[model samples]
Every structure is written in C-alpha cells, then in structure tokens.
Target: MATFATSDQLLVIIDPAARQTDGESVRIAKDVLSAGAAAKLCLPEGPEEFARALDRRGSRRPVVIGDGRALVRAVTLLHRQRELAGCALSVVPVGDTALAESLGVPGGAVAAARAVLDGAERRLDLLVDDSDGVVLGALGIPPAPGRAVAARPVPIASGRPWYRSLVRTLASRPARLPAVPSPCAARLRVEVDGRTVVDLDQPVVTVSVTPGTDGVASVEVRPLSVGAEATPLLASGRSVTVTGADFRYRADAAVSGPVRRRTWRVAEGAWGLVLPAGR
Candidate 1:
C-alpha cells in the first residue's frame, strides 16, 4: 500500500462545469497524483467549499485545477488570509486559452502539473481595485451603456490618456466594436493626490486606474474620444474614490457595486505568489 506524505498534500478545485464537460482532465490529474509520492490531491465540491478548504489549509501550496476564475478565487482567499507573506499559488489551467495564454501557461494540464511539481516560487504584484478587490496583472473597465459598452475592437491603452477600451453590445453578432462613451465618466470624479483632475459635467464612459507606489494613482480616463487625448495622471496617495448614481462596474473579471461610492487603498507587497521564471 502506497501512502501519501503530509508535505505532499495538495488541494485541487475544479470548476463544476469544466469537470462535467471534460471528465478526461480530472481523471488524468487524479492519475498523475496517484502515480507520484510527491503530491496528494484533495478536491473541493464547489466554489464556496473551495474557499473553505483553502481557509482550513494553513500553509500548503494550493493547486487549483480550473481556469482563470479558479486563480482569482485562490488569490482572493489568500488576500483575505493575511497569511500570504510567503505562500505559493500554483494553477493547472484546464480550460480557456485566454488566461493561460496571458500567463504563458502551457496548454496541456500534465505539463502545467509537471511544472507545479518542479517550479520555483516567485513573487508577483497584485492590484487592488477601488472596492478592495484583488486583481493580478491588468484591469479592464468594460463599457457601460451611455458610458462605455463591451466591444471587441481592441482599443489602444498606450499613450497618456490611454484609450482604455471600446464598448459594444453583446446582442450584436460578428462583434461590432464601436467607440462609445467613457464608462466611468457618468459616475466618476477622479482625484490625484487630493487634486480633482477629472470632474465630468456630463455622463462619461469608463475610468481605469493603475495604483502605484507612494499614493501615486496612474489614472486613465476613456471617454467618447476616438480622438480624446487622455493624459495619464499619477497621483501619490493611499485612497481613490469612485462615486456615481449607484451603478455596476467590472473590476478585473468580477462585477461589483451599485453603491454611491467605492474606495480602494493599496497594501504594498501584501502577498507573495509563484510566477514564471522570467516574470
């Protein structure tokens, strides 16, 4: 009888739908764990249960077996833990190429699993949204109607007032991406270091902020400008407030808010995560 070691304990949370759609991946992952003395896998029933499992897990490196959402759930849990000072996060991206492509994760689950067994832990910066939401890498503010809409034309976010993105309707087929209004203009009054930089008299579209060091908020405003010069403003401060008539906005991949105001404060180097060798 082969026994698993306590140090080899691993938690695997697979998305319910993904497991249903592709049973092979889960089966293969289980076999991979069974064949090795280095890993002992534990599966969570669902998302809520997954969180509970992670919470119960003191300091073990969590290995999530879903797509990007799984990664987000893990990060969010670690953020709430306050114990991520030196915890490693490993993911076996089993679905969708979007998130994995962005992270340079291999397309195969076995390869990702192999990397998990042999990879070194690296620290990566996590972004905090206005609502205290934790996001890895970049954040996208999807267009709101009368503000910015969800489009697929791929707007440029390069220059100062980087065109954050375009908004299009989900109903429209063939992905009709139109340059719409700013998503946050209707409800956002951007202030940099206590100085009001953008005060929208009319309804604007979207506002995206990349929070940086020393109270510096890298603010980018995307309005109805196919030609609007958006000057990226960096403000040094600890707080950022977004106010409106109670509207919903996308933070990272999660939808939050209908509140009058939502503010975000940065916690520098809050968590340590595992990343690729080059990153």
Candidate 2:
C-alpha cells in the first residue's frame, strides 16, 4: 500500500486533545499548513468525528496535528480500516511528541507543518497482535505480585500537569485497569520465534520488545535474581509470545491486559509514515 499524493492537497485533522493542550501551537500549525497547501481542516470535537474525517478523506494527504495519543488514534483507526499502508500519514506534533519525534517528525509545530507539506513517505514496521492491536513504539512487561488498588477517583490534586488531566480521566475510570506493574519479580514465559528464552520457573524483572531493522523485533528479557542480579536474555525474531497468570504490559503510552497469553508478529513495512526527506 502506498499514497498517491505528492503535491500539497491535505486533510488536516486537528485532534481535540491537541486543541486542549496547546491552542497556540495548533493555530500556528494550521496557519503554516494553510499557507503552504490546499488544506481542508477538520476540528473534530471528539474521537468519532476525528475518525470520520479520515474515512472521508479522498485523495487528500492526511496531516495530523496533535499529541501522541491523537497520533496513535489516527494510525489505529487507519490500520483497522486496512488503509494504513495505503496512505502516507504526516503529523505536526503538539504536546507529548516523543513517538512522532522518534519517527523523524519534528517536535516543533511550524517545522513539522513544513515537513508535512514537503516530506517523503517512509515505510515503517509495527507490531500487530493476535487481537488486532498494534504497538507503534516499544512494548514492555513489568512484574506485579499484588492486586490493583481499589478503583476510585484519583483526586485531581493541585499542581498536576495539564496532560495529567487526560491521564487522570483514563486512570480514574470506573472500570479497573490492570494496576501499573510493580517492580517485584513476576513469573512469566517469553518466547522468541518458538524458542523459550524465559520460563515460568524464572522470575522476571522486565521484558521489552521493539521493532528493529530487517523485519525482526529486538527482544530482551531480564530475570529477577535473588543475589547478584542475573543478566538479561536477549533475542530477535519475527514473532514473540508471552504467557503468564494474568499479567499487564506497558505498550507505548498505555498499559494493557491481564491476559493469560498474547502473541505479536512483526508486520514488515506494514504501514507508511511521512518523514522529512533525507532523514
């Protein structure tokens, strides 16, 4: 799948979170993009409209101007529609730009806006799970020996950052999410390409997997040692499977699952992202 647009006809979707986080940056990006391209701007109030914008975007290039979660939401929506690789997606990162920055999008809105109008498409690898979920960056499994704290409204105490309001809404929800995994040792089984690197007998401190070069994932499993900490087990493979008794994992910016088992496979060049040319 590949995008057909080369010139600057754009569908600029400004996610609401970005508008809430930093309106000035959003305005600046909008100005730059409007000045440079034939832009159709969409100021969606929420996720449903944000998604609909993409579904209706004909041949116009989609340039997302928002925070990390918005970027993930855009990609996730397109991917679910099976159009991820078919379109070249650009982003003008606003708040929490780490994931976009890592993929070569500039951190500054103005610069990112310029790149969106004049960038080359770069096909990137992303992890796809059996449950049709994706991890855009790294994935981790941390140990937790105890149950989660009773669910309640974590008071929006003073001095919490603006971004935390979004986080607070998510964290303080009625449904109990898996508690943030503790640092304690957890019994888990991790396998890379069918070889078991970590067995249930061994307690693990953490396990990490990231998309690496040449269509494989770089996997690292660190075991918990009683004395004189043990070395981490490392391997790379096209597929990884993790199993344990109800565990949670940190995938990119969110924590997911108390699943008994999950499997992820590398989808080689399965999605395309727009990046500054010569990057």
Candidate 3:
C-alpha cells in the first residue's frame, strides 16, 4: 500500500545469497520480471548496498528475490525506517523460503514473479522488540544461530559448567544442538500482557512466540516437570516480556541476544505483501 495505485515501474532487488545458492533460479526470476514490467534491477554484493537500494526506491514498488533471511532483511530495514506500513512488498523466494511461504507468497520464481505483476496486497501482523527488532515468523528460545554448533549456559545450584552434549552431523548437513539446557535447565520469568505465566523459581525447557492471525502474539513456555510432564503454559496477548538470566533467541532465521530482559509487542496489520490475487 505504499503507492496509491499500482504502477508498471518496479524496483527488483536480487539478493547475493540467491545467486550463490541457486543461480539458475535467479536468472529465471530476472527474465520473468523484466519481461512483465518496467523494472530497475539492483544486484547488491552485500547488505549495505542492499539496504541502500531499497531505501532509495522512489515510487517504484519493491520486489525482493532471495531466501527467508533476505526477505527478513528487507522487512527489517523498512520497519526501521517506519516505511513498512506504507510499502507493499513483492517476494520471489529462491532458497529456503519457509518464512516467505508461511506469509502466503507463491513459491518458485515463475509463480512468485507472476504474483508480483498480478496480485493483491495482503496486510499482516508483526512483532517488534524494545530494541526495534522485528519478527515476521515464529520465534524460539534456546537460540540456534549458525549452521555449526550452539551452546547456552544454564545456572545450577552449584557454580560449574554443564556437561557438553553433541548431536552427530551427516553428509553436508549441520548438527542441531539440544534446545533446552540439559542437566541444568534455565530459569526464566515469562510474562504475557503484564501477567506472569512462568516465574524464575521454576526451570524452563523452552519458549516460543508467534504472531497469531487474530492480531495477538501466541506465547508458549515449557517448563521442567518434577513428577509428571508439564503442559506448556500458553497465552495470547499484544505484549510479552521475559526476564532472568541472559538468554538468546531465534527470531525468524537470525539469532539475537544475550540479554537479561526483552519485551515484544504486536503491531497488527503493520505491513503489506503482494500475493496471488486468488490465493
């Protein structure tokens, strides 16, 4: 909804990750977009150039061609500049497009490019943190950052390091670490809309926050059970807060924080995306 009316002018930003991951797909997307509209392509080598290209987009609508992280990168920049509410983004997911797919974008280059040229604007909700970070998809605790390994420290009754636990990696796939703090579970206080759902006294297993379709964030906190398996504490609210020991979390596909406290609030219908008209 950035522009009052749809125009043929388009700003196509092809991400470097897409080129590196799948060059053939990128080429196909480029061919389709250029043939459909009056497009100005920006092939940025890095993040800075990418931000610059999008920031300088005048009246032309932005069409991002890349993976989930690239899409998040675009949204994050627009949100930071307070332009997300006004701009409607068109996405062509090239590699690992789980986030883009969840938001209703048609997968693959041809389908997505077609959507960009002939589609309707669909507005959606998002979560923004105190530090101005945004989460477009589901967020998970016990953060998994890289393609390698991850370790998060948990405080035990006695001050000592927890034993290291590793998962085996096969082929070119990366090993996924255990999500919870094993042996010594992490103690965290989770609050949903000012009400404390899980306090620091109890050790936590994991937590997740996802933007619900009903304009609120769905929160789930799994705590360590003493006798029986503990049912995950669930709540829905416009705001959520977590405090206690420092913890890292995965927002969309990125890792964030070693912070003691963080708060996230829902911004309902905050951004718009162009999707297939019938979809």
Candidate 4:
C-alpha cells in the first residue's frame, strides 16, 4: 500500500550525535535514501545548525536521522516555528531506538530509509504545555529519589509576597545547613479537566499521561503504599495539571524542570509522521 516519492520531495537531516556515535548507520541510511530518491541531505553539528537546516528546507519533507532525542528536538523546533502541522516528518532512529520504536518508527537504518520513500502520512496528537513545550509521546512523573528528583534547588524570582521573599532570603543565609532529607513520595494535586483526582494530602508514587488517537490524554496516578488491593486512579481528558513542591518529569527522552506546577493538554492531529503504508 506504500506510495512512491521522488528524492526531490525529501530532505534528510543527519543529527551530529548519530554521526559521532554510529557513522556506519548514518552512512547506510544516507546510501539508502540517496539511492531511493534525489533527496537533499543536511548534517547539522549542533542545535543552531539544525534549526538553520530546517529553515532552509524548501518544499521537501524532513526525515530525521538519529535517536529519540533528535526526533524530539526536530519536532520541538517545528512546533516553535508554528509550521509543524504543515510538515510530515519521518525518522530513521540510530542509537537507542526505544522511543522511536514506541512511536512505531522502524529501527533499522536501511528499512527506515526505504519507508521514508514509500510511506503514508499519519497525523499524530501532541502534548503542549503552558510554556509552549511539546511532548511527542508519553509524559511521566517517576518515583521520588528517581530521575525526577531535583539535585539542587533552583532559584525563583521575587514576585511573591514580602514575607515569602524574606523567608527565602533567611533560608539561604545559613552558613551551615542541616543535612538534606531523604527522598520521599511527592504530595501532588493532580487534576483532570478541572476535577481533582488526587489531592495534595495524598502521597503519590507515580503519574503517567499519554495522548490517545481519539484526541484525549489518558492519565493514571498511583498512590504511595496504597496496599496490595489498591488500584491506580485513571481518567481521560484533554488537559491534565499537576501541582506540588518542586518536581521534575520525563517527557519523551528528556527531563524537564524542578517546577512546582505543570499542565499538559492534547493538541489533536497537530503533526504528521510518515510510516509504512500498511502500518
């Protein structure tokens, strides 16, 4: 069921990381793509160059060659430019293909390149945050002391009440502070579509939110030590908000923030991906 595409219609972007880590794979992908179509190839050494390459891309479809992080970076750039909806991206995952595999992208270099030349475009949902950040796949708050735990406190601006600012100043003035406390479960206030699913008093073990094809995000919250019979709170909605003491979360392959609050909502069919026709 795959449709054919000419090289003139393709733009191949090879992430520098992929080239450094696996030159063979990058070469193989390039070879396949070159043989299949008369595509233009871009080898961006860093983020700025990557952006420039995309900006220079005329009417050709972009095919990213790298791992999951590269894919996320490309999508984020397109999203920021407000041109994501008009572009149909294809990815040839290089190193550590876990995230790409989850997104249904082929793992091998040659196979993925071939798919790019003969594939169907499928629009996919995205999670957009209040800060304009984009998440291509699932977002999760892992267990405390895990990857989400902040190593050090990040300074916040003094727009708060005078008393609160005074306390923050006093707390940082201590020459010798007490030992840092061991990590414990987070007390989060999780809301879905304006309804509270978990309150601040509840100790949360973990939380996960994934956008579905139906344009809704499925949210699941697990309570800390809720006993063997306890079940996770699950719901589906367009928006999900989590608030608590400073915490971080993993979105796709990246970890973002030691923020006190974050909200994500589904932007249905916000972007498109090229996949094998029958897939």
Q: Which candidate ranks first by lDDT, i.e. highest? A: 3
Least well predicted 10-residue stretch by lDDT in candidate 3: 162-171
Weakest ten-residue segment in model 1 by summed lDDT: 162-171
Against the true structure, what is every candidate's RMSD? 12.1, 10.0, 9.8, 11.3
User: Which scores greater on lDDT, model 1 or model 2?
Assistant: 2
**Cand. 2 Cα-lDDT:** 0.85
For candidate 1, lDDT tens digit of each residue in 1-279? 122242466655566655775679867765665465245455677878888877776545677777777777788877776666656777777765456446555557676665565555655445666545775544434334454445545543555432332223323348444655333346456665566656656345666655443334455655443475554444445556666676566654556666676666655655554444444
Model 1: lDDT equals: 0.59
lDDT of 3 by residue, 1-279 (tens): 322233478999999999999999999988988888888999999999999999999989999999999999999999999899889898999999899999889888899888888888888899999999999989888674346365654433333333222221122366565576433367889999999999999998788999865689999988888888889899999999999788988899888889999999999998888988865
TM-scores, in order shown? 0.68, 0.83, 0.83, 0.83
User: How much lDDT does each candidate structure score?
Assistant: 0.59, 0.85, 0.86, 0.85
Candidate 3: lDDT over CA atoms? 0.86
Query: Which candidate, 1 or 4, has the higher TM-score?
Result: 4
lDDT of 4 by residue, 192-258 (tens): 9999999999888789999877799999998877447348899999999999889898898888888
Task: Look at candidate 2 and tell me the lDDT of residue 257.
Answer: 87
Question: What would the per-residue lDDT of candidate 2 be over residues 1-279, giving only the tens digit for each residue?
Answer: 232333569999999888899999999999988888899999999999999998999989888988778888888898899998788888999989998888778999888987787777888898989988888888989733345466566565567587677777776778655756545778999999999999999999889999864689999998887678689899999999999999899777778888999999998887778877777
Candidate 1: regions farther than 4 A off: 1-9, 27-37, 97-107, 129-132, 142-185, 211-217, 226-238
